[model samples]
Target: MPTLVVAVFLAFFAAEYAVETGLLLLNLRRARRSGDAVPAPLQGVVTPGSAARSRDYTLANGRLALVSGAWSAALTLAVLLSGLLPWLHQALAARGLAGAHRFVAFLVLVSAPFWVAGLPFALYRTFVLEARFGFNRTTPALWLKDRAKGLLLSAALGLPLLYAVYGFMALTGRAWWLWLAGFLTGVQILMVWLFPTLIAPLFNRFQPLPEGPLKERLEALARAARFRSRGLFVMDASRRSGHGNAYFTGFFRPRIVLFDTLVAQMTVPEAAAVLAHEIGHYQKRHVHRRLALGVAGQVVTLWALSLLVPWPPLYRAFGFAAPSYEAALALFSLGGGAFTFFLAPVASWLSRRHEYQADRYAVALVPEPGALASALVKLNRENLANLDPHPWYSAWHYSHPTLVERLRAIGEAGRPA
Candidate 1:
């Protein structure tokens, strides 16, 4: 029965990959034929030069994704079908480590190889592709510094978090998954509070928005939404890429962060519109809804892991001599994507729905609907977004609606695109 289940899992995994890769290839072909001419919808939004550049950019990234995704997927599958998990578990166990210490150490060791394998690809993407397109602002030293910070932070936070989780599991037995889900759900919410003040500063400098019209407009919007924003801030996002964006960070007191590049490029009103859109997300309770969905997903996942982890043949399928939490963790972390890819479309749909609601709320706050649409257009151009993604591809992968879809929604709200 376990072997049958494993076989079924592999089949589902294969089918999921096939569907995802098929859409990717379709999109790639669509992009190749996309041409240098700007579409009518984006005619005023992006210039011909920018459109041509976006085509090239999308193609380059698509090819990179294809090759890199294949490579990583192959690596993961090889490890699962081989006895690598069991071998690694034994090697770590031989170190006389036990419980959470053993598990965290095992994860670190196993993930290190893949992380190292990926460094060259990461370097190429940042230094070569992004640089070719004039997007790379990261110096080699900065890149290295970022990586080191991430590694240190991972150890700093992840070690203690995993230890507590394992401790709960030991205490709860069959109900460990429930305990874990509850603990992690709290942590997820807590991180939103901690991120703006604690974790983000480690990577990029976040300075308060200088007092001016822009600051005044944002605060006004926050007040209109009845949200006492923590504050409005500017992020030094130009250190890495040319992309411009704005977002709300933290939970209790959500501060608005506009990329310095975004501020530099767009007008103050457009910037206000963009911030309105972000604040709209908070006002419409989108963040809370997303957190709820994430928590629900985590609960389901932990429950699934509980049922699957103890099965002997599932581990044997991965060459584990016996069941080990460390081995199970590694398998799930590495291989679970293949099992869950089917949910992409559903998740994308939910996100797109939320975005429409947020867009409506943004217009309600900003009044000039075109300002939001115009801001969206400027962002699309700046980010080199694909103007006309295939419907299935968009459904599968797009968290937000495309420029066309968004403009249509805005038009419904009397925003002329």
Candidate 2:
């Protein structure tokens, strides 16, 4: 049984790694073939220089991804196959650490190596890669501070939550997974609700949209769409990067936030169009539907974990002498992606469909027919987004449709039904 499990693990791992490497290489090749030429749909909208930059950006990031993905896969496989995890568990047990405390400590310790290994890549991506393209604005001090806060926040929130999960597992009998699933779903929803007000402020300052025409326009659009929000606000995203975005957080009374860079770059109509697209998400209930789907996924994952946690051979396959919930959870978390990687395209497709729906809904609400398309084109150029991507690569990776697809869809959206 152990041998079979190991074989299955290695097979899935190899397949996932091959697929990832192939898609990245294929995308890079496709980008090289396309050169700097702006896609037909975007020729007039985006300048040749911007298109060239976008191509370079894509190639650079793709190369980085290829390297980083291989490194990550290799490190993960090494850690899993090594007797290190079993040794660590035994060491922790030897130290008189037991139960949830020991489990949390073990997880924290095991995760440290990956975090340390990733720092250089994260730094390069943020400071070197992003800065080369005129996107990075974060100082090293700010970066360090942010990481510190993130770590502290993780410990504060994650430790307690993990302890609670352990408690549920210990006390809830055979249906523990069901209870844990519901609890986790509720926690997820609560985090979403609190993030806009509580968690977000820790990282970046957000201010009210400042009683301007843009604010009035966005509020009016929301009212027109019959979507209620806490308020419109702008985030100081420029403090970190030049990339612009807009999103709403929270379940009820969500706050619509626009990146300061977005506000600075886009015209009033363009901003309105962008906000209208976000509002469209709410109007179409995409947010609620996605949330429900996420909860369902969590339920399924927990149920699977319940089934696997007790199997002794599963532990033996990974070099653990005895079945331990912590080991099982760690192994599952580490290895589950290889098993479920094929599902990414399905998720991406659903997300893209939602995006299309939101875009169409925005078109109906925005005063100018081409406002949303114009905004999208500007965003793509400003963000140095790849205007063209290989079909298979984009299908598997992109949560939102490509800029060209979006522009074409926006045009269709303006037409009479």
Candidate 1's C-alpha runs over 4 A off are 1-6, 415-417
Residue-by-residue lDDT tens digits, candidate 1, 166-241: 7876678899999999999888888888998999999989999999888887778778778887777899999999
Candidate maximizing lDDT: 2
RMSD of 1: 1.9
Candidate 1 residue pairs in backbone clash: none
Q: Model 1 reaches what TM-score against the true structure?
A: 0.96
Give Cα distance to truth, residue 97, candidate 1, Å.
Answer: 2.8
Question: lDDT of candidate 2 vs native?
Answer: 0.91
Model 2, position 30: C-alpha lDDT score: 90
**RMSD versus native structure for model 2:** 0.9
Name the regions of candidate 2 deviating beyond 4 angstroms.
none
